[model samples]
Target chain A: MINSIDLILVLILLAVLLSLGSSRMMALIKIMALQGAMVSLVPIFIEPQARLSNGGILFFQLMLLIKAVLIPGLLYMALNRIAIKREVEPLIGYHASLLVGLGLVMLSAYITRRMGLSLPGDYALLLITAITTTGGGLFLMMSRTKAITQVIGYLMLENGIYLVGTALTKHTHNIYLVEFGVLLDLLAGVMIMGIILHNINRAFDDVDTAYLEQLKD
Target chain B: MLEAVFCLPLFAGLIAFLLPVKLGRGVLVVGALLHLQLTLLAWLSDFPPLLPGYFSTAPAGILVLLVTSFIFVFIAPYSIFYMREQEMQSEPIFIGSMLLFLGTMSMAALAEHPIVFWIAIEATTLVSAPLIFVNRSKKALEATWKYVLICSVGIALALLGFFFITLSMDRAGIDVPLTFSSLNTAAKHLDPLWLKIGFIFVIIGFGTKMGLAPMHTWLPDAHSEAPSPASALLSGALLNCAFLGIFKVHTLMVLAGLGDFSGSLLIGFGLFSILVAGIFILKQPDYKRMLAYSSIENMGVIAFGVGIGGMALYGAMLHLIHHSLLKSSLFLSAGNLLLGFGSKIVAQCGGMTRLLPRTFVSFFAGFLGISGLPPFGVFVSELLILIGAFKAGHPVAGGLFIASLALVVAGFARIVTSMSFGPSRQEILVPEQTLRIVSPFALLLTSAVLCVWMPEPLHQIIINTIAVIGGTIHG
Candidate 1:
């Protein structure tokens, strides 16, 4: 039966496609923020009847805050700092990327069906969305030229992995602690990338990965 | 008490961030010494984990910890002298980041929980990024960018692998804690299919950080761009932390009766890395980049030996320790060369034999030692691995191993000869100092001494480390 969890998962998939096709950096950041919030809410929806303790409530809220507000906020600041607006001249054009995104959905669905792991409560849809988000993130990284976009892609990849972790493993006592640490690392990684983005802009007048090809062997 | 081995350096690093540059340098050295003392204490005595579930002193973890601590004791002091000659934008940040990097690596070594190990490793990448970019040059910025983005993504996959491992346990109806030690004990119950998938992802994830080829693109650039002492630590200590992650998982695989699958994969990556390093080292322009590729080669050697099992696993352990010592020494001596000639390009350097006599001795000796000459531990380790490979009935792979070693040595010799004996080209920029030269010599001497006389405790540790995987001392 259709439920709120599937709705959220479907929205996340749409956001992934939108991110792949969007030419503007600001729209991409917004898409990521929406995707992050939706992804963080999946665990709550999956286990709605298993009332969360105080610690679990606080952990989920913190996850939502970081995933939705902090990370995209950092990217937004980084975008403004670098002063780059539109993603110019992607390696793959927008239309092709959109088509590829659809292909990724089908691929993920097939794989999820092939390895049937008796998950509970619309988790098949969740796994498909997770795999598509991951593949989309990796594709974005390889196909985009801007460093900021690559960071966005990395965040998307991380969100997908987090979803996989949630859907696959049962919640243990220390799981929240580990997840919190991962969230903090995500925050710090974005901050460091922001600093490097500013430097890359100052040094080269652009944040394009094209200019970073000098030191290669 | 075991936690203090990492905690001491971390607190010191936080203080280094606030202190003045002069005092920060003092903190760096003192922190290193205290860390070494704590490491010795943990090694010599039984120091129980403060957090029993997440942190423990396993044999493999402690071995990596000891090697890291020993290398830091020398690299910390060498960094002080190395930094004195050149001005950095933020000296305090550099020193602070070095200590934080040490703390993260120590945490990775001693971590028993899978997720905790992943956290420690990811923290290392963040902390060490500052060390690479301390110079703030454009190339340094590029290198830092690659190092962070690549390692973060790579380690993210490792986290996914850990999740898969947890999933395997869940599928088996096991309710054990998620530490590696517990995972090993419960491994036989895990579904083999999921375990295999987890190992693939884990190896790719950790192997990338360990500088295994096909994922080692960031290594040469980051190592070459980082300041010398930072490069030394990256080569000597940081890579071992990543290898420890892979080694732990490989042991789990062996326990699960997946040794052949994991071993073949390790051998494949190992040989590929050696080939890649050999090809790149030939016609290499930068001396520092050459040393970085050499690190990739050594990592490959260690992976190969471990994959072969039996006597070769013991060789891998010896190689791990000796590689840390000799490679750090080489990088320090290369630092002296950079200080003397003011260039990293080999063609721009010449007549180090005449220009800097003391550095020349250490550099040439390091070259010989790294090339697997006698009076050094690499020679012994390489011989053991080769013999182990043949005995394991992998004659073709053994032959390729020897061929690649020859190619690497030939390329390495050409570069070393020209750089040391080529016609005099440039004037010395900074005169050699006793402090700058002593650490490298001391590091090299330690390797030689260990080769001649294997310490009882270290030997016992190696035995304990490989005993689970069916590795024996006698061929």
Candidate 2:
């Protein structure tokens, strides 16, 4: 089950995420699409064993389709609507974010190793991918300045959490519903927040949080 | 009927949405009264006992729900005058949202399921978001933004903490359900490592909602920017709802064999919040924000007491009750001052004692009660917390607690003396001519009575109830 295709998929995901944490907002969306592609393969890699029930396979495919493809498509539409161009300024510089993302990836691996998340004792790369994606998403959140960018960061974080649950298929079933609910909620959250971002830009002429100080005492 | 306590508010919220504006504000009071009535019924029943997981009301939440419901009852009428004075036409939306906000808070308190509790907590963030935006001011929008972003991020981390709690139970080979009963029953089997991580995340998440230090940046702005009645609910009841989450999780942490891990973290965050509030309040120029920061400090004291554990949890719960009354009164009075003097900055307006004697007196009383002066509820709560800290061998925290309280007291003293008792700036002062001016007086009186004497029967029940929840893990 340790397929070369799966390894290549994860490597591409990593390369894309490395781009997401950079100042290039357009590049961030491309990386998101690549990460999206890798997430769709997670179910196949986890259990190509016909040892699964029909219902399980159906749900798996549904998750892959909805999460990896449909959600990204919706976000792409939003990107076109808002037209926020590349991030003009970020709270933390993009280069520093890349370094921090690297450190978080390392931390995720360490934490996973401690928790024994590597299933089949052979899929060490799965553990690495889970941590890297989650860390990268968080890095996007911390470094990004644009409000839309923050929303995108949150979406990537959801992708990371999805991988965590997917890797743990051997342990539970109830978690699948929770993961779906989380994704739905996250996607809805991004869409609503995107609208709010548009309003902020329209009202203030800039979506940067720098001018959000109108409420202070 | 027990579940009805939460559902009734939801129903009221929906009905309010369909009503006329003038009728809507009036309907909000009706909803709040009904909510209080339902809370009393639940308090009298056995059906809604803490769920079968870790810790719930047989220990800590009964008192929380009762006190919160009781204060909401008083604040409901106060809100009527608040709305009427503003000539609010969109009352239905505000009232409906407020009902949902309170309903979700009760759900969080009475939740048997951990996931249910998280959902309820998240619901509060959504429902309260609209309430903060009730004024639709630029400032309101800004504050609402901070409130939503910070609290949502905080609650998300809390959810992650829930994930860790489940992960820990998995490690221990016990099928510990997320219910209070199940968690407590299986607590001994929980993995310590995962519990530590879970407790930290839960603390920070709920702590942000509670306005605990470092994560408390949203409290002052949101509290000061919202309408007074909303601020009353926020400072009085909402923070307690968040604290209930932390308290419940800590109960499980104790049973997980990582004794004091959660408690120490609470104490650390609590003490830091108090110190931060004290430092900032000493130089604060805005009185409303100062009061907001004072709230952060009081929440810190409660956290410290809860972290101390054992007897300290009881003290923490007691302080939770007293502080709610004191703070809501203070905020309501701030509203009166705002109405009378039309300014929030301390330097811009004053001579309140000469301008409006009744409001000035009530404001000072609230300030005194919050400062832990004798004969008030805060004084008694503080004493209990200090005793609990010493009992838990946290004498250093106890010492720092006294120093921080003194610093806060001094800062508040200067503000009260300067704002209420002395010179007025050039701002125009209007004469009080309506019932709205008198409503704050009434709220402060209820709080004053609670401080002076929390009826014996209620106190006995609440104290016993808290002990049961707090002791569930240890037993």
Candidate 3:
């Protein structure tokens, strides 16, 4: 039987795939929230020793709140205000993006296998999931035309990095304060991006970033 | 003392946000003066870090701190005049963000720990985003969006790199602190594979912020679209902070005996940046964008110098100082031109020598200084870098460096000469002001003076900074 950790990792990978295939902004935001919650859970499950500390528990709770609730809530609010229900005229088609997402997962798996890193059991899977999530986020950012989608992409990227941090770092080395700072930065980043998205909508009458081509060389 | 260096700005920024526009501008100037004074005091005498583990002033840190502080003291007053001419609706926010941006950059400069540095660098992006969008124009909005998204993504990767570094320590069973100094001392015992991987990520991440080639798409747009004073800070003070991040990691790579691996990457990115900038500079239409590309080229030079090691590293340090001075001056002068002609298109800015003689002198002088002309510190720095490149036995790289420099100079000459002598366009929108012109002039003068004479303390600091990478003045 697959362990709970492996199950959660697979669920997170599914979230990445769903985000890539989904065209609706609301769906993407929901997928990110789910992914964020899963990413926060990884630390607690992977490092049982970390759960012993009250500070770690409090830090994880804070991370969960921000990553899962605060950031996605901000993006959701942006989506409502902008009223752009879907990412229109994406630079790439959805079918092609889904195919690219599949290729990314396979490539990440190949990399993990070729590196021969002696990670603990199932960590190679964890690494593969994190890499795919990160790559998918970047692809989303590059492929989608809407500014809101790019913000979601950035949040996805941060979530992946958070996973990498959890998978690689030791429990004892994880300082709650530094992690808190990182989370705060991420929250603030998403909020700021949301504000800009609102302004872009106001200025251009839509959230699409194709209008931004005016500044090119 | 270190707390005061950043705290004064933070406190002033809050007040500036609440106050009236005129008072807010006053607070900004006062805060800049106080910040610069604190920076000088910190430089002259060492004090224990207020927060011992998180913050301290290393030689490299102080070098960047000095540049940031010095440039701000000029930019602050110029901004008052600049905002007044524009009559910005969000003057308060602009002033507040400027101060906050200064505070965050100071924090980055003084940060000793990798995570602290990461947070501080990321903070610079958040704080400066408002300054870019303060204009509320469509182009400003685009620039701000791209700036925030690209930089935040880049810095996120840097966080992963930091994790890998921690992983290296875990694998090696080394229990040292995560400070750069400590890490450097323990680097030899760390896992080399993980360390190399970490270095690559850090370089690419911070290199994106540093405007190195292939990752520099955001630089031209953000710099050209932001208000001139904000562009000056972004180009001058902010890029140096990103370089400090890379330089710190490179120090660790050197200590880990992987200097060759990291050095070649820097050299490769640096040369490509120069080539790219050279190619784009040749036919650039917008004057501000041209200067922005020039900033990219100078950054390339600094990176190349550092990567060459030995004497070139010393040259890189000097290039860092001179580039900050000259490029900020150029941006500020470009601001005056923008104000005078009410356009950023180079074609519309002809006969600048006659139209705005005061700005022309500073603008033309700034061009000469940036293009590595004599009587300027950049001349000395570029000469030193070239000599270092040859001394390091990279003759092909040296040749390419020279060729790129020639192309840049040729392109810059054509533009500056045309802007100076070509037929005039529309009438001046806002005539040049003494207050606006003073900042750029002072910066150019500083570069010229430093070229002729090097102060002992500053010279010693440069030596100490480069010594870690095996750099010396005597090639």
Candidate 4:
């Protein structure tokens, strides 16, 4: 019997799927936000003892607060400012992307189960988070037309990995430092990328990657 | 002072940033010199006291720090020339960012812990993005975008790999310290499943940064699009930083009794990288992009050689040095040509030799050096790798290596023939302040000369570092 709270994980999985299949760039960014929130909750659902580390509940919630809520919102605002409104027709199309994402998820499950793997904790939520992150990142790269979307996909991928980290590993100083570094770098990256993308759109009059083939042989 | 080498650059980056723009370049040069001296000092003396925090280095990072510092030294005069006539206020910021890139790489090499190394790797990606867009052009932005996207994904995966290593160590009841030495000692007892999982992520992660095939989509674009100084450092030094991380992981795998599995996987990617370069080079239309493809190929060769242990790992180490020297020179000369004649496309350009004599000579010298002409550093290193390949009883692999290399040579020859040999198509003036582009070319000549001249001091440095790396992994 599936517990009611597990619905959040299922819905996150659904959001990951929708992000993979969506053509609307704006909609995909929103889906990314939902995915982030879902992944952040993974720690509580998966890591038990960690649930009590110095108001650990709030601390664990911070991962979602930053990763899920903050990042995607930042991305959406970037997209809005850039005014790059269009359906993302990936070099590879949506139907094929859906097929690949589905295949990868199934493969992850099959591979993990067959490996006879078991962690110290419940890890079921953590496992699902990892697979979702990997699959979503792959999908984002293949499914998005804009460079911004691809970066957002990469962020989603990192968030998924962080979910695994916080959920499974002991809360060490080094881990926290790694987490902070990752977030700061990713944020700085987005800011730098936003400036560049704005410049690209202004210069080329079209941020479509087709125009980028000038340097290629 | 291993710790000092790391600490100084970080301080220097901030120092360089705080200095005036005109002084910014000089400050960078001083910081590099100080950093290099300290690294040399560390190598000569006993291990530097490990600062009780997250960062440190071993015998390995001393060599990494030295090589990167030398590259900075080489680029200094060149950057002085490279940045001339560049716009107003952004100059300081740009130079500051480049210093930060070096500082981050320094921390990475000097780090004792896995996470510090990962942060450094990711930070290099962020710092380098602006360098890609130095010209503020549409094309530069696209290249920068691709670079940011691909490498970000790759490094993120690597960070995940770091987490996996931590998890594996935890499973082994090893107290989960996450230091290189600690992990190395416990690696043999780690759960094979977790170790394998960690390795897959590391390979994919670092492999992207190393410009390995499949993950190499960003390399050629970023290389061709960035200014020459950035391209030279990108190919010469930056890729090496990523390769060092991968090398450390490979060493850990060797200790874990997973040497064969990891080696086999590396060889697979290495060969694929060469094949991709071969195909790309054959049809390549842009001369700069062609050089970029060649970098991918040379890196592929190193990866393949490293994967096939025995004499091969030593060969890969040697190849890494040679590739850095020759590739930097090649890209620098390419930069000279682009400035002299305003085009990277092979078909549009002609008679470059008559118009730009010194640039032509530099280009030819770089070409000869990179194409493995006898007496050039690349020739010696590549020949060693070929011999290593044959000794490993992989004649098929050897043959493939030879063929791929030949394909690059012939393709590049066609590019050079059209671009540098014919009659003067027009009067080509060198860019206003590009006189110092010759520095990288001069450095290349020096490196090539060392390969033949084999001075005792230099020989000691190269041979000892190779042995240090090889001794750890060779069964």
Interface RMSD (Å) of candidate 4:
1.9
Highest lDDT: which candidate?
Answer: 1
Model 3 chain A, TM-score vs. native: 0.96
Q: Between prediction 1 and prediction 3, which has the larger TM-score? A: 1
What shift in Å separates residue A23 of candidate 4 from its native position after superposition?
5.5
What lDDT would each prediction earn against the true structure?
A: 0.93, 0.74, 0.90, 0.75
Residue B439, candidate 4: C-alpha displacement in angstroms: 1.1
Please provide, for model 1 over A1-217, each residue's C-alpha lDDT reduced to its tens digit, 9 standing for 90 to 100. Answer: 3488889999999999999999999999999999999998988887754527646888889989999999999999889888678888999999999999999999999999998888765579888999999899999999999999999999999999988887777766247788788889889999999999999999999999899999977
Residue B100 of model 2 has an lDDT of 81
TM-score of chain B of each: 0.99, 0.93, 0.99, 0.93
lDDT of 4 at A194: 70
Per-prediction share of native contacts kept:
0.78, 0.17, 0.87, 0.65
Model 1, runs deviating above 4 Å = A49-51
RMSD to truth, every model: 1.1, 3.9, 1.5, 3.4
Q: In candidate 2, what are the lDDT values of residues B21-98, reduced to their tens digit?
A: 767777778888888877777666565433234224453566778877877877777777777667665678888888
What DockQ does model 1 achieve? 0.81
Deviation (Å) of B369 in candidate 4: 1.5
**Candidate 2: CAPRI quality band:** acceptable
**What's the distance in Å from true for residue A138, model 2?**
2.4
